[model samples]
Target chain A: MDTDATYQAPSVDEIKTLLTERFAGKVNVTKTETRRVYATLPKEIVHEVCEYIHEKLTFEHISTVIGVDMVDYMQVVYHISNYHTGTMIELTTNLDNHDLHVQSISDIWVGGNWHERETYELFGIIFDGHPKLERLLTPDTYEFYPFRKSYKLRGQE
Target chain B: MAKDVLDIKAESAVMDTDKMWIIMGPQHPFSHGLWTLKIQVDGEIVKDAEPIVGYLHRGWEKEAEARSYPKIIPMADRLCYAASMTYTHLFCMTVEKALDIDVPEKAKYIRIVADEICRIQSHLMWLAAVGTDLGNFTVFLWCMREREFFMDLNVRLCGARMTTNYPRIGGVRNDTTELFDRDVMRCVERFEKVLMDDIVTLIDDSSVFVSRMKGVGYLTREQTVNLGITGPAMRGAGVDFDIRRDDPYDNYDKIDFDVPVMTQGDSYSRYQVRIEEMLQSCKIIRQAVQKVKALGKNAPYRLKVPSNVPAGRSTVRLEDPRGESLMYLISDGTDKPYRLKVRSPIFTNVSAAKPLVQGCRIADVPVVMAMIDMCLGETDR
Candidate 1:
C-alpha cells in the first residue's frame, strides 16, 4: 500500500559521495542496478562501512553473509537492506588467501552474528571481533571448508 | 543456589529461587524442525534462551555450486517445503536475473498466481500447525480441510502439491489449463465463505485461545527492525513494510492489494497479520486469474532458455511465505553457478528466539515458536 511517489531515497551516486567523503575514496562501487550494489571496500573499513549503513543510512536489515572462493582471493558479500526505502546494498570485500580474514560487523547488526559464523565455517573466513565465531552449519569434526573451489566433493569437480 | 538445588521441598517453603538448564529439542514437538532450544529456567520462567540450529543442514549452497543452473531448481524447491513454489520461483527469478533473461508476459502471470496460491497454502499450513501446537485439534482439522483446496489447485497447475519445481529460468515450465482458473476461482470463493465463519471461529471463539495468544511473546517494533525480522512478524509489530508492494516483482506492482500491519507485536497480532495475508493472497490469485484470462485465445508462456547462461552475479529478494527470502547468485559464464548463496528468512527469524522466547514460561515456548512457523530445511540450508 506504500504507493508514495514522494518517498525520495538517497540515490546510489549520493551514497557513493558519502562513501567517498567518509572513507576518503577507499571504497569503489562497481555497479548499481535495481536496489543491488556491488562494491569493494578496505578490509579495515568494513566495520565502519557497516556501521554507517546501519546508523546513518538506516539500512538496519542485514540479511546474511556469503563468502566465495575466487581462486586467487576470497569474496565476502554482506546483503544489507532497508525495507522502507527498498535499498539493497551488496557490500563486497576481497580478502587474499594469505589473510582470509576481515573485521566483523556483528556489533552493528546482531543478525549478522549467525551469518558471520556460517560464513566462517563454510568458507573458512575469519571474522575478527565476532564474539562467538565457530562452526555453524557444519559439525566441529567435519574438517573441510566445502564451499572453497579447491575442496572437491564426490561427483563434483 | 546449591542449597536450593539440594533441598527441593524444604526450599519450596522459603523463597526458593534456582536456575536449571533444559534442552528442548533435537526431537521435540515444540520445535518444528531439527533444531534445539537450550533454556535456563528459574522454576517455570525462562531466564535466558539460546537456539541451536544446523541439524538439517544439507549444504545446498555448496551443492548448487557444482550443479548446473537448472539442476539446482529441484534442490531449491526443497528449501522451504511448506511453500515449495515460492522457493523454486525465487531461485528461478535469481537465475533469470543473473542471466538477464526476459520472462514472457503469460508466464509472469502464471508465476504470480502460483506464488499467491502457494502463500495461501503455506499460511494455512502454519495455522494448522499452530492449532495443533496450542491444543486446538479442531482448528487444525478445519485449516487442513481448507488447505486441501489450495493443494489440489497446485496439483492442477503443476504436477506436485509441495515440491512444485514449476518455475524455470526464462519462464514457468508449462502453460496453464482451462481447469486451473475455473477451479482456482471456485476454491477461493468457497474458502472465503467458510474462512471467517467456520474455520477461524474454532480458534477465535475460544477464551483460552485469546488468553494464550493476546500479550504473550511480545517484540517491540524497534527490536523487530534491529533484529532483521521480516514478513508477518515484523508487520505484527506495526511496521508498514511488505516486499510485494515495496519491492515489486512479477507484475505485483500492477496488481492492487493491501499490506496488513497490526500495532501489537504479540502472538495474536502475528496471527491477525497471517489471516489478513491469506485474504490478500486470495485477492492476488483472483486478479492473476483475470490477467491470465485477459490474455484470451493465445499467449506465450515459456520463453526459450539456454543451458549455458552468461556470467554475472545477481542479488534477488522476495517475500516468501515465511519472510523476505534472499538468493545471491554468481553465474560463471557456464551452465553451472560459481556460487549460489541463499539466506532463508527463518534462519534469522529463528535466531531471534533468544529475545522473543525469553522471560516467558516453558509451556509458552510452543505458542511463541509455532507463531514463527519454523521450517529448518530452509533455515539449515
Candidate 2:
C-alpha cells in the first residue's frame, strides 16, 4: 500500500504539460478533474500517444475500452489508470464514419486485448494491428454490431 | 486364453502424442456457470486455454439504452446475483455523477454497510464453491451455513436476498429499517469468530486442502496487471491496489480497513486474500453501522433527484466484491442514457484464464478457476 512513496508520479499539471509538449497540435486536453484527465487525440496518432503514455507516464493498467456510436461518427474511449498516483486518463478518439479503423494499443498493454475485441465486435471499429480481433461477447457467425444505433432493440421503432 | 499375448508390447509401442482439446463448460460441473473453457492438453497437462463466454449475455448495455435511468437499477442488480447491491450501487453512483449530486451522509454510511454485507456473503459463496471444487463437502456445508445469516441480513435490510435492487440514483431505495444496525453488527461479530476460529482452521490446518491450493496456478505481479486482473486476485499477486482504499468512493475513505495483500501470487495466495477480505468487510460493516447510528434515524437516506440527466459523460468506478466494477454513463439530456458501458471486472479477469491455467493439470483447472470466483451473470453482461 505504501508503494506510492517509491515512485515519483507526475502531478496532473505536469502530465498536461508533458503531453502537450510532446504531441503539440495532435492532442487536445478536454477536461481535468480530481485524479481524472480527459483528452481527445487524432485517431492517426493514437498508437503513438498511448505508447508515450505507457512508457513515459507509467500508466500501467488499462481499465477498459468503450466504443460508442455517435450516429454520424464513432468514438472509442480508453480508460487507462496509473496505479502509482491513483489517476485515470480517459482518452477519447473519434473515428470517421467511412473509416472506423484505429491503431490498437494491445501491443503496449496486453490488458486492452479483450477490450478492443469487444469494441470491435460491438461497434465495428477495427483495431488495425490487434492480434485476434474477433467477436468476444457475440457469436462469431452473428453478423451486425448489436450496439450500434441502427440495430434496434426488440419492439423499438 | 493367452490374454492378448500376441505382440502386446508391439501393440502399445505407438503412443498417441498429439495434443487434444478438452471443452469443459456450458454444461460441465466444473464450470459453475454457463461459460465454456476449452483447454488444449497433452497427457493431462494443460498447454493453452480459451474461455468462451456470452452464453449468459443479455445485451445488458444495449438494454440500458432503451430504459430510463431509474429502470436500470433493477437491471444492474441482475448483473451479479451474489454481489447484487454493489452493481446497483455502482449504477446509482454513476448516474449521480452524471447528474452532479452528492448523496446524504446517512445514505453513504448505510450503503457502506450494505456493500460490506454483500461482500461477505459473496466471499462465502466463493468459499463454498472452492470447497466443492476441492472435493470437500464439509467445508461447503459449513460455509453455506454461515452464509445464510448474511442472506437474512439482506432480507432484513430490504426484503430481498439476491438481486437486491436497493440502491437508487440519488442515494438508496430507502432508509435502513429498524434494528438493521443491530442485526448487521451481530452478524459481523458472529461471522468473524466462526471464520477465524473454525473455518480458517478447517481449511488452513488440513494438509490436503492446503497442498491442493499451494504452488499451482501461479501468476506474477506483472502478469496480473498486464492481464487487467483486479480485486483480491490482483492483491494476491502483490499489486497492492484497492479502489476503496486507494481511490475511495462514498464513505469508504471515512471507514478504516486494511487491504490484505499476498505476494506468493499462487492459488493459495488468492484464497488467503479473499478470506482476509471477508474479515475486513466485517470490520468495515461494524464501523459503518456505528457511523449510521451516530447519524441518527432522522437523517436523510434517499434524495429526490431529477429524472433527466444533463447531456454529459461521467464515469464512476467502485470496489465491487469481485473486482473494480466501472460504469461509464453518457447522458443526452433525456430520462434515458445515451450509452451505459459496464466494465464488468469478471469479464477482464476471466480473459486471463488462458494464462492462469496453462501448465497446470486437467484436475487443477477447476481449483485454479475457482480462485477467480467466476459469476457469469456479471462476466457475460
Candidate 3:
C-alpha cells in the first residue's frame, strides 16, 4: 500500500495549524456558532488555501461559492464540503468595491467555474485565472451587477 | 393559383444564411414557461447552444427578505412547480429547525406520505415527457391519464392540484381524512399494477429505444461526484447517496425502502432508476398510509410558528425525487428570514450537461437534458 494511503487524516487543529503556517495569521479564523468552520483569508491566499484544503484535507467539493456586496467591499465565500468527514469549511475573502480581484478555484474543482462566473456576473467580483470566465446565468449585455447592495431594485431603494 | 404559387416561391426564397439564429423557446410548446434556448445550428448539427433564463425570476430570495416567515410559504410553491409541495415542506422545515420546533410523530408520517405521492407524480411526468421526446406518443397519453388520478387526489386533499401549500413550519396544514386515505390507498393499488405493466411495455418492450439510450450520455461515477450531480441522475451513475437515507428528515429513518442505483450511468439507466423509484415510492406511501391510519388523527395538524426566531442559519437537506434538495435559512431575530438560499438539485445537475454534451450528437442533447428535468424556475431563482 502507498504511504499516503496509510497515513491518518489531519485533525481539525492540525488543519488550522497548516492554514496559519501558510498564511502567517493573515486569516481571521472563526468557528461559526454552528458546526462549520469559517475562515476569512486574504484574497491573495484564497487559491492557495483552497489548494491546501482540497489536496491535503480532501475537501474536494466546493458546494457553493457566493458573492455578497457590502457597498464598500464585496465578499466572496466558498463553502467547501469534505465528503469523507461530512464537515463544511467556509473560506471567505473581501475585495475592494473599485477593484474586485480574487483567484479562481476551478483548477481544484471544476464545479467552481460556473459558480464563480455567476458571482462575477451578479456582483462584479473579478475572478482571476478562471479559464473561461464568461457571463453565466445572465445576459451578455447586462451593464450593472444586480446583487450589489448599492444597486436598487426596479422600484425600491 | 398563380398568386399562391408566387407566395410559396417568395417564402421559400426568403431564407437568410448569416447563421440564422432561431429562438426555440420562451413561447414554444417544448418549453415549460418563458425559458428560451437560442440555437445556432448548421443544418441539423448545433454549433452553439445558449440558455436564456430569468423568464420566471420572481426575485424569491430578495422577496423573502421582506416578507414574514409564514408569508414565504406560498412563494416556495412556485420554486419547482412539479414538486411544489416538496419545496414548501423543505422551506418550512428549515425555518422550523432555526426555531427549534419539533414536529409531532403523526405529522411526520403525513409529510412523508404527501412527499412520496408528489415523487410518484413527478416521476410519472418525467416518464411522459421522455416518452414524448422519443416519439412514443401513446406512452405520454397513458402516463398523463394515470397522473391525473393523483392530481385529482391532491385537489381533494389541499384544494389545489399543482400548487399545494399543505406543509407548514411545525407540521402539515391539515389532517388526513378517511376519504383522502381511501383515495390514496386506491390510487396506490391501481398505480402498482399500472406502473409495472407500463414499465414493461414502454421501456422493456422497445428494442430500438433501448439501443438508442443504453450507452448514451454516460457520466462516470467520478465525474458525477466531482460535478456535484445528485438525485436520480447521480444514482443512475451508481452513487449510493440519498439524503433520506443519509440524513433522515421527517421520519424517513422509520421507513424501509431501497435506494435504486444503476451502474450504467446513461439515459436508459436514468429511466430504469426512475421507474424503480416509482415502485419504491408506492411502497413507502402504502406503509405511510397504514401508519397514519394506525395513529388515528392523534397528530397535531397545525403549528403556531414563533413570531421571532433566533438569529442564526440552518441548512436542511431533503431528498426530492430529482435528488438531494438543500434549503439554507438565515434569520436575523425577526419573523422574516434575512436570506433564504435554495441550492436546487436541478441547477447543479443541469450544469453537468456542458461536459456531457461536448462530443455527442445534437439530437441527444434534448434527451440528456430531459432526463435531468431541470425546472427553469428553480434554476433562475
List, residue by residue over A26-83, the lDDT tens digit for candidate 1.
8888887666666788788888888777777677688888898899999898888776
The deviation in Å at residue A98 for candidate 2 is 0.6
Which portions of model 2 miss their true places by more than 4 Å? Answer: A1-8, B1-16
- Estimated TM-score for each candidate: 0.95, 0.96, 0.85
Q: Rank the models by lDDT, top first.
A: 2, 1, 3
User: Which prediction has the highest DockQ against the true structure?
Assistant: 2
Winning model by lDDT: 2
Per residue, candidate 2 scores C-alpha lDDT tens digits across A58-89 of 88899999999999999999998988888888
Model 1: per-residue Cα lDDT at residue A151? 87
Q: Give the TM-score of candidate 1.
A: 0.95
Model 3 pairs in collision: B231-B323
Model 2 chain B poorest 10 in a row by lDDT: B4-13
**Candidate 1: where is the Cα deviation over 4 Å?**
A1-9, B1-17
On residues B1-381, what C-alpha lDDT tens digit does candidate 3 reach at each position? 766566766665786656546676788655556676666665555556656666666667777777898888999998888888889999988988899889888888888888988998988888888887777888788889888988987887788899899998888888876577889989999988988887547667898777767777888887877887778988898877677765578799899999899998888898888888889998898898888888776656667777898997677767887876777776889887866777777767766765565445657666777788768778788
Error of 2 at B286 (Å): 0.9
Model 2: chain B TM-score vs. truth? 0.96
Top of the candidates by TM-score: 2
Write down the lDDT that model 3 would get.
Answer: 0.77
Clashes of 2: 0
Residue B284 alpha-carbon offset, candidate 2, angstroms? 0.7
